[model samples]
Target chain A: DTAVSQTPKYLVTQMGNDKSIKCEQNLGHDTMYWYKQDSKKFLKIMFSYNNKELIINETVPNRFSPKSPDKAHLNLHINSLELGDSAVYFCASSPRTSGRAQETQYFGPGTRLLVL
Target chain B: DQQVKQNSPSLSVQEGRISILNCDYTNSMFDYFLWYKKYPAEGPTFLISISSIKDKNEDGRFTVFLNKSAKHLSLHIVPSQPGDSAVYFCAAPCGGNKLTFGGGTRVLVKP
Candidate 1:
């Protein structure tokens, strides 16, 4: 079974259009995350939710918002997307444990977004 | 600033040879390190990991080495096969529930 999955494997939209990418994990993990991989293949964490609570919010702009309905799902919504929004968005989840640093994350296939 | 840095952008190796990928970190607070393999059109998959307390960790043909004093880490794949060609990312726990990833090194295993 796919442990982590994301919808809309590819998305192409015009500038100023809004889009949303959904993510779900069946690993029963308590923490979910949204990451952005740029053209340079640099992966950066955008947001993280622990037990449906916002825990990590990076330097991402307000145009991007992440919502976690429960421990199993985390979705990302982009408002008025721009050309700079073109990149691959990845969703990941990790089990909550006492050793937070030692936790391993599982990532979904990712959503490729293109804004013309 | 990029906390984790993989200076090598690409590496090519012959099949059945050892492929070494290196990563460096500027943050001393990072206690755990991980290596992930990613292919085109797919997300990264966890390959191996090593803790700050240990210098090395091995799993099958994959091994990760950590140098706390130098704040460096390396991933070695022995007897690399063509199927092992992919982008390798080195990551560290940035704090709380976040991870700081490197720029990634693309490995090409030549048959």
Candidate 2:
């Protein structure tokens, strides 16, 4: 079984459309994260949920929001999408004992989102 | 500002040779450093890491060296293999909250 999985491996939509990316982990992790990789291949952390509580939120636009109904899931929802929102979004999870950034992070297959 | 930097956009090495990936940081407050290997269409996977207090750490064929003075660190793969070809990224925690990542360096292993 996949440790982490994301829905809609490839999502293409028009501008102003609302979309959501679902993520789930089976590692029984306590923490989940969302990261966006731009065309330049630079990755930036969007949000992190520790035990279903919001923790780290970078300077991402307010249009993006993360929700965790349970510790095993962290979904990303974007409203009124724009062209700049087109990028590959990755979902990852790790245990609280991962010892900061030193601990290994398990990532999903990544969702490629394209906003026309 | 980018706290971590991988100046080399890409690198190439022959199989059974040494692959040296360099990384530099501007924040001295970063006491811990990590190296992640990424394949296309996949998320970054942790390869190895070292603390500022230590000069080096090794795992199997992969070794991570930390030079605190230069604010630099490197990942070395001995006898590189074609399977080692991938993008390698460096990360460090300013404190304990989150990790700051570099632009990443693409490594190509020639057969």
RMSD (Cα, Å) for all candidates, in order, is: 1.1, 1.3
lDDT by residue (tens digit), candidate 1, B1-111: 999999999999999999999999999988899899999999999998888889999999999999998999999999899999999999988777778899999999999
Error of 1 at A91 (Å): 0.4
Candidate 1: tens digits of C-alpha lDDT, residues A52-98: 99999989999999999999999999999999999999999999878
DockQ of 1: 0.83
Name the candidate that leads on DockQ: 1
lDDT of 2 by residue, B2-87 (tens): 88999999999999999999999998888888889999988888889888779999999999999889999999999899999999
Looking at candidate 2, what is the lDDT of residue B33? Answer: 86
- Counting clashing residue pairs in each candidate, in order, gives 0, 0
Tell me the deviation in Å of residue A70 in model 2: 0.2
